[model samples]
Target: MALLETLSVLSGVGGLSFGAYQYYRAKSDEKRKQELNDLADELNDLRRDIDGIVETFQSPTTKVDLSHQLDYCTKDVLAYKHETGDNALVKAEKSNGGEKVSNAGQALDLYKNGDTYPRYHLTLESGYTGYESNLVYAVSDHAVYINHLYKTLDKLQERHKGTLEEFSPGLYDGIEGLMDDFVEDTYTNILSHRDGIKVNPDSHNNIEEMGRFLFFYFWHYEGITKELESLSQLSDKIEEARTTILQASY
Candidate 1:
């Protein structure tokens, strides 16, 4: 009778121990899920940043850069003392000709050999020493980066409809983007995107798989976030340069 009673008590103790273990595991799993959820939250933040940059940067950058290019000439102009001597000669009434100069080609009155002696061969103040201080080149690079980023990320968002990431191409997709993103044609120092090509893009393969989306979500997402952040910073810098150009133009 004593052994039987002891066995019953032991049984109850064992069941409580198991219950505690199960509760601990449940709490651990919940913590892990929240951690994984943070990854998604970070990616969403990057997407919003990318979209905001694309919206604000694209059209205005083009207009500002284009206007700067066409309106500001670096050629030798008859830099005579006008009423107000400013660097940029955009939209002015020429002293040589009473006609108003509305564009950049008209800004710098080209030096004629017989006419002016102290002709100034002006370099655009925007560039560092010999370069122009415009947003054209930097904006070009930014365009490529951000454009691909937008399309790729947008597609990723569409494909990542939650179910283990099956819909989109694998991140290691193909050569189509490789050429424009870069091509190692010169073989100079062997700088190449050799590794990225090895990854999945929904493109490079034919076999339909279920895990490619999640693979990128888990692995490539952080790198992508970094890229978007860099682009955002670049966009702001470009905008500042654009503002400088505008101020100089006037």
Candidate 2:
């Protein structure tokens, strides 16, 4: 009987020990699960903060505006009237003709006589030896400018002749003689000056002076932007005419 009672006591003790061990294991598992959840929440908060910073930096808040201006010249007409009376041809009491007739003619005359250039010859007589070098340079420069101007004129004449051949043959024929005369005069002047330079190399101080004169002459003549403007206008007109002809053909 005593043996049976001891055995029952030992079994109860073993059961109590197993129940305590199970409770301790359950508490440890719960603590680990709580730590994992905390880590996951912190990671989500960090990602949200990074996203907000990115959005703030990527926003556009500035704007810009730009503009430009251009200028040009055009002819102006003051008055125009038509008369149906007996004296239909009422001329002006006093008129200076046109700008081209007056100014262009004067310019042509000056150009022909070399008056458009500086009067270095007169300046040379002032006994100013210091300016002799400058005078030589000036003369050389003027000669070069005239030569380039003649070449440019020749080109313009050729273009004018080609255009006349296409559209205004009669006008071309009438102007041909005048153009020939102008060209001949220009050539004669150039050859005479070139020959003069060869004979009077002493008149030029040095090779440097000759070079300076040639450069300045070409620079001035080549600086003529008016021809470029005229060429651009001609190109535009030609394109317009071509387009019109193509459209008509179609």
Candidate 3:
């Protein structure tokens, strides 16, 4: 009878141990699901930013660069990493266990020491003269935002298992390529004054005297208008991609 009691006590302890392990596993699974959801939500927000970029590019007085200028190489758009780790949107864990938090903006800005910043620096106001009135200023943030989206999508691809599998692979590259081409052309046209054509305000060529040869012709970039028309295609591809990501969980 003593042996029976002892056996019963051992069985009860074993059952409790099993229950504790099950609880831990369930909690762990929940955290994983929450983390996946957070990534999906982040991916969606990045996609949405592109729509706004399309509009901003078309406007005449649109100020696309950061309101304040900095040496963008030292502080590119992704520089938000060193800024904060607190995300107010979603909790870091599945449960309200205050352990670690995440912010999408901060995640994108995770590092500054990279090769990408130099290209980003070229998009600043100094990228081209008269950028404020033309495409350089217009393309600055658009480029950064698109770069963020591109890098974010690459990250999600690595993070996830499976339609969400790079639904539109070339879409990111296409938009980025167009922006790059436009920026390149703008520089070539604007900087022609230095070596190719003399448009500098010199003793020979007065500012008012160059009126007939208006720089407005330079802003009429064939590529910008061409890309503008194709914006619909860009929308369709990304909308489909976002749909796939939205349906995904973990």
Candidate 4:
């Protein structure tokens, strides 16, 4: 009778243990499913935010704003460069008039020898009239602008790297390519124009090209702004996912 009682108790304990194990497994599975659902929701939210940004870019109002920004940046760079020469001239005159009058005058005389009077003395000149002129600044500005746009595209690419595998991978991939193209074209144009600017600052053709390119490049800001909106949406979605995951603990 004692043996029988002992066997019954053991059986009961084993059944309870098995039941507990099943209960825990179900709970864990539920938790995992909730977490996944949360992640999906967050991704969707991110997608919406991104869509909103893109929509804004498409809006005329936003385009106008971008236009203004581009104009300001171009104007600032050009104005700065243009005045650089004048500033240099003024300084040269003042210094020459003072203690180094004789030396300064001699340098001026040497510089004024040709139409390209300051070719050799460009180093001493106040502005970017020499080989290392502010022309480089202009080039760098354009290049940097292009790079800035490219960086946004890069961000999109990074996000899509692992996360978009289950969703619309093809669409995201295409968008990434488009962004890359925009960056590449802008960079190419900048380089081409820079070469032109360096080779002939006074060439009517080159000057016109430079102006056109600058204007066009300014428009890229609009695209970048739009891309940023999309990225923001994606971030929001990610946040939503995290929140959902945390709340699903029970």
Candidate 5:
């Protein structure tokens, strides 16, 4: 009878122990689940913060609009110069019996032969030397402005090279080509004219060289105009790229 009673008590103790163990296990599992949930919430919050930061920098509208002011300044310079140069030429030609000299040599010959120098020649020389300061000032201002534009395009290419090419393959190529042409040929010719025989138009060989230089100058001028036009297209493509990237989920 004593053994039977002892066995019953032991059975009851074992059941209580099992029940306590099960309760502890349930509590542990619940705690672990809550921890996992908190970590997931934190991760989601971090992702949202990162997305906001990325949106701020990669916003195409903000970045592209930064260039508008500089672009306008460049446009103004080119337009002013083109207008002044053309008007000066026309006026001078009209004054000289409506016979516009086709080349620099012809103009130089007329100037050298004791003919009152055409107003255009004087105006162009002065204009080339900056309506404000000296020749160096004019060239420097123009070159610096152009270089700013070129550098901006270069950085845009570098930052979005893959995307830009995928979207507009020849865009950067055109910019680079025009820049190369200006640096190698157009800029060199202008510098040569400025430094050499610019003051002395009496030399026939020099005048001929000037004629050739002017031809190339006009060509480069046309190229620059086209380059400026391409900016609008580039702006559009950039906006498209931004929209595409924004819409895609990471």
Candidate 6:
């Protein structure tokens, strides 16, 4: 009877031990699964970041350059008469009682208007001899193009402000300053000045001012080109970071 009781006790202890082992094994498996799920979520987030960087790089904003053309008025008709001996309005009136002249005063009355304006070329540095005007649309689309790039960078900064700041605080600040400068200094001062000169061609001050401003305008062009190249590098860096994170996680 003692032997039978001893055998029963041993069987009970063995069953309890087997139950504890099974419970621990199941818990371990559950923990491992949770860890794997967490890693997958992290990886997905990194992939999304990568996609965002690529999308920004692909944006039309990045394609902006000096290739586009701006149609802008260069000289006022009456103003041109004072600067140059030739009077375009008088000639037009002589031809047909001013029937072809538009109230807007654009010299190129025949050209369809929609963001295009009369083109003018003047050089005060050499001499205040005369002015030339045309309707041909070519390069110097800097104003609107730079504005688009500035806005694009602004959106990108807002989207990844925290990440960018964490990666490189100075760079983040520099980009912020660049956007502001492009709007306030480059776009506002240079482009606006050009427009002012084009519209007020009769003003001697406006003409003279543009002569001096041309130097700065060309200089700004070089600066903007360099900034764009830097921005391209930044985009590549972001992509590289995303790739590194993914590789490390794997």
Which of the predicted structures, 1 or 5, would earn the higher TM-score when compared with the native? Answer: 1
Q: Which lDDT tens digits does candidate 1 get at residues 148-180?
A: 444444443454334212212332122123222
TM-score of each: 0.31, 0.23, 0.42, 0.35, 0.29, 0.31
- What lDDT score belongs to each candidate, Candidate 1 first? 0.32, 0.31, 0.43, 0.40, 0.38, 0.38
Worst 10 residues of 3 by lDDT: 86-95
Tens digit of per-residue lDDT, candidate 4, span 1-250: 9999999999999999999999999998897676556445544543544454344334423344434433433343444456563322110112111122233233233222212111100012214434453221111222222233334434545543354444444545554444344344333333333222221223324333433344443223435655555555544544554455445543
Q: Write the per-residue lDDT of candidate 5 for residues 9-103, one digit (tens) a residue.
A: 99999999999999999998776555444433332332333233223222312323323322332333344456564312200111223224445
C-alpha lDDT of candidate 4 relative to the true structure: 0.40
For model 2, residues 123-227, the per-residue Cα lDDT tens digits are 011122233421121222222333344343444355343532343344323323343343344333333333122112233475344333332222223323443
**lDDT (Cα, 0-100) at 139 in candidate 2:** 24
The positional error of residue 141 in candidate 5, measured at the CA in angstroms, is 2.8
Of 1 and 4, the candidate ranking higher by lDDT: 4
Per-prediction backbone clash count: 17, 0, 1, 9, 0, 2
- Best candidate, lDDT-wise? 3
Q: After superposition, how far is residue 238 of candidate 6 from its true place, in Å?
A: 5.4
Off by over 4 Å in 4: 1-7, 30-38, 41-68, 74-186, 195-215, 218-250
Clashing pairs for model 5 are: none
Q: Could you list the CA RMSD of all candidates, in the order they appear?
A: 23.4, 35.5, 16.7, 16.0, 20.7, 15.5
Question: Which is the better candidate, 1 or 3, if ranked by TM-score?
Answer: 3
Per-residue lDDT of model 6, residues 1-250, tens digit only: 9999999999999999999999999998776555444433433343343333233223312323311211111233334555665432210011211122232223222222223332222222111334353333222233233333444444545555564444445554664454444333332333333422222334435533432333233224435555555545655554555454344434
Query: How many clashes would you count in candidate 1?
Result: 17
